[model samples]
Target chain A: MSVTYAAVQWNRQKKLYDSVIAGGVALYLGRFVGVGAMVHPQATAETLLIRGLGTAAFLLLHVVLSIGPLTRLDRRFLPLLYNRRHLGVTMFTLALGHGVFSLVQFHALGDVPPLVSLLTAPARFEQLGLAALTILFLMAATSHDFWLKLLTPPGWKRLHMLVYLAYALLVAHVSLGALQSERNPLFVGVVLTGACVVLGLHVAAWGAGRGYVEVCEVERIGENRAVLLKLGDEKIAVFRHGGKVSAISNVCAHQGGPLSEGKIVDGCVTCPWHGYQYLPETGASPPPFTEKVAVYETKVEGGKVLVSRCAKTSSI
Target chain B: MQWAEGLTTMLGVYGAAGAVFAALFLWKGVAHVDAGARGAGIGFRAVIAAGCVALWPLLAAKWVRR
Candidate 1:
């Protein structure tokens, strides 16, 4: 939709999204600080900041990760996907705060630079935390549309998938670091439950689309739109364009966006996720770009369109 | 403990270097693919470049596939 670049594309939805994020962060911090002070009156300010920010960021990350599979499971979660960048940036900021405070508290007095200290620290989980922080930094920096436009949707999405790795690293970070020293079973339980929920949701969402080779009439697939067909674990998009019918992988070659939701643009099937386009006939991008999606064979039988259960490579 | 410690340190060193390389690749790869992308301001492009760096592996995979 954005053909031109702007410094900042502000809108009502973005304003509301940012406000809710800010309010949620403030409320989370207040509650965390209040509870921490009560449980351990002797805890210092630095400890409180580290604990609060780290935990909050971890929780936010769980939410951020959940949004994808949740949306796949139910379309109601699409609203969260629209402004997910803000959620990510806010989470990264909280993580940065935690990293900075931890550095100052534990490594500032040391002779080595904080970066060096962080790398060489004797702590077991420092590396994991550092890795997670680095990934978050990349995600935050490229959260803008400018990057998306340049990176192309597929490239940008591929890059953002590093979030899964970052999440794993962070779980290890907590497990090896604070979780190790903290004796409270409740805290451990919460961490475990969070990881379980994230993992469980992903598993369920993935399974939801499996086990069905849905058959739909070609006539039912409206012009310029796609019908999403699930063939076991694979989701295929059957499109009818200009009196021709073709089927392609529902997964956007970039970022795994639902190609079924995308419309045909300029004779190519466009991905709604980031506007990457592929030819409906061959599932290949137009000349000069090498992006391609798996193409499926479709046959007409008795005045009905039948999409194949497996993908057949189209010669483009 | 010794083996674990060594493995962790090795991952840290490699991971740091990998991050830098990935970011650089994303920046260049995106610009290469999209002609209009290079027209953007340097600051904004640099940010995108960092994202590429962060996701170098995925970008690399897609780049080779293309």
Candidate 2:
């Protein structure tokens, strides 16, 4: 949304979102540690903190993962998608805290160095945790637009897709590390439920996206607005602008943001995530910017907007 | 044991180098390559510096070319 990037393009919504995140994290950690102290008087503060942070991070990761599919299912969740990276960075910080605390408590006092001890630890769970942490670090480090621009949208997306791998690793890390010692059925059930919810939502969203080429009645699309369509694996945005209907790949050239969620501004399709704009007809950014997205052929027949699955042309 | 020691030493060297490079990059080199970084506040530079620590080599290459 900015010609020049600052630390963040801070807005009222982002400030509120960050405040909520900070408050929620503080409350979760305080309540968790306090309750643990009362429940297990013998447990050390470090142990409680490690457990609290680990669980909080795990829970936040679920929320972060769910936002994508949730937004796809309903536009109401778009606000959550807007500041999702902050959630991710916060989750990484929590995970890093858990890792550091666990390392200091279990590995630091030993003769071997902590990193070496971690890698050499007999429990494969610790190694899995380390692997997941590394992936999270990579993601957190590159969360900024600087890296996105440097890596390009597709490459950056590919790197971030390793989150799925991190998620799987963390699941194994928790199951093999904590679940082995804590044979509590409730804990197991909660973990299973979180995983299932994430998986089920993704599957449901995929199903919902299918067969959207016959998008909707042309009248349903408002002027200067768009309707999202998914033909096979491609997400296309059909826009009604200037009394002409045009279709373009919904993915933005910058950061792969959903263009369909955005509206036309200055005669260009402005991305909702960031204000990256593209001419609706050509799917190319305005002059002085070189970015382009794939354009698709669209037609109005029987008052329904139909989009071609194959791109008419791609200048990406 | 030897490999771990070697890795630890290599990482230490890399970390030391990265820290130095990151400090200098934040001080001067960042603005040279990225126009957005010019006149940006310390917070922005700090974030960029964090990335610079890990990606100093790449940033260094860009700096040299610039």
Candidate 3:
């Protein structure tokens, strides 16, 4: 949102967000490593480091992925959406630590070069882990808004969708790599449950609003204001602007900000998250900006607003 | 080891070329696009160029498109 960026735009809210993140990591690591030591007294420091960081990173990834759908389902989670890049960068650091220590512990000190051994590793899970790490590195490297501005919002969002691919690879990495040899059934259950929860939350969020549904009264949608209506599994912003109602995807193109919560300013629907603006009718941003969101078909019937599942444009 | 060594050497060469390509991209290429990175200062651009060096293929594709 700036011509030039600071190292970080820190504020009181960000301080609180980062504090919660750091504290959560510390607590999760302490419990995991402490319990691991008690369960396997013979485990080495390298083993503990690998497991602890891996678990922490995986858990954080789940939370990061869930935040998007969670905010769509309920706007209370919007604050978490504001600084999700920090969460992603932190998760990448943890995953990188896990990867490095794992390579040192298992791949190094062998006849072959560590890099070669890692690449040529016969282990199926190891290959998946490497693929996941590559995606994570790409995501972390471009987490800055500079990339978003350069790539354009749509391109940037498409590239960031690789996170889902990374998640799938990491799931394989865990189930095949760690769970295969895990003695504790509790650890296995925890890993499976984590995967299931992520999948279930996404599916549930996707199914929230789909078909034609009555949203709210036309009078309720005040001028220059928006009313969020659920359809299938997504939220749509039903806007009342210039004496007409237009519906667009509630998720902002830039970082999935809640557009329903945003106010129409200067004849454009302004996103509350990063101030990215879009035309209420077409969902396209003002000229010189190419960002857009899915526009839904809306028709008023008997003083009630109804939205169709079919998008106005195939591309949002 | 031999395969890894050869690949590393190739990447090292490519990395050097990528640095130059990224600089050219930032200076000449980005200026043309209306939505491209116009306001990014030298320091930020350098970091992006370094990223291009490490991830040459992806950045090169994006740079070409831009």
Best model number under DockQ: 2
Report backbone clashes per prediction: 3, 0, 10
Top-TM-score structure, candidate number: 2
Clashes of 1: 3
Kindly list the per-residue Cα lDDT of model 1 for residues A193-298, writing each as its tens digit: 9999999999988787443244677788889998888764678888988887889998776788899999999999999989999999889988898888899888
For model 2, what is the alpha-carbon lDDT of residue A48? 99
Model no. 2, DockQ = 0.57
Q: Which ten residues in a row have the lowest lDDT in candidate 3 chain A?
A: A1-10
Model 3 TM-score on chain A: 0.75
lDDT of 2 at B10: 92
After superposition, candidate 3 runs with Cα above 4 Å error:
A212-294, A299-305, A308-316, B1-9, B15-50, B56-66
- TM-scores of all candidate predictions against the true structure: 0.67, 0.79, 0.73
Candidate 1, which CAPRI tier?
A: incorrect
Models sorted by lDDT, best on top? 2, 3, 1
Instruction: For residues B30-54, write the lDDT of model 2, one tens digit per residue.
Output: 7787786777788787766667787
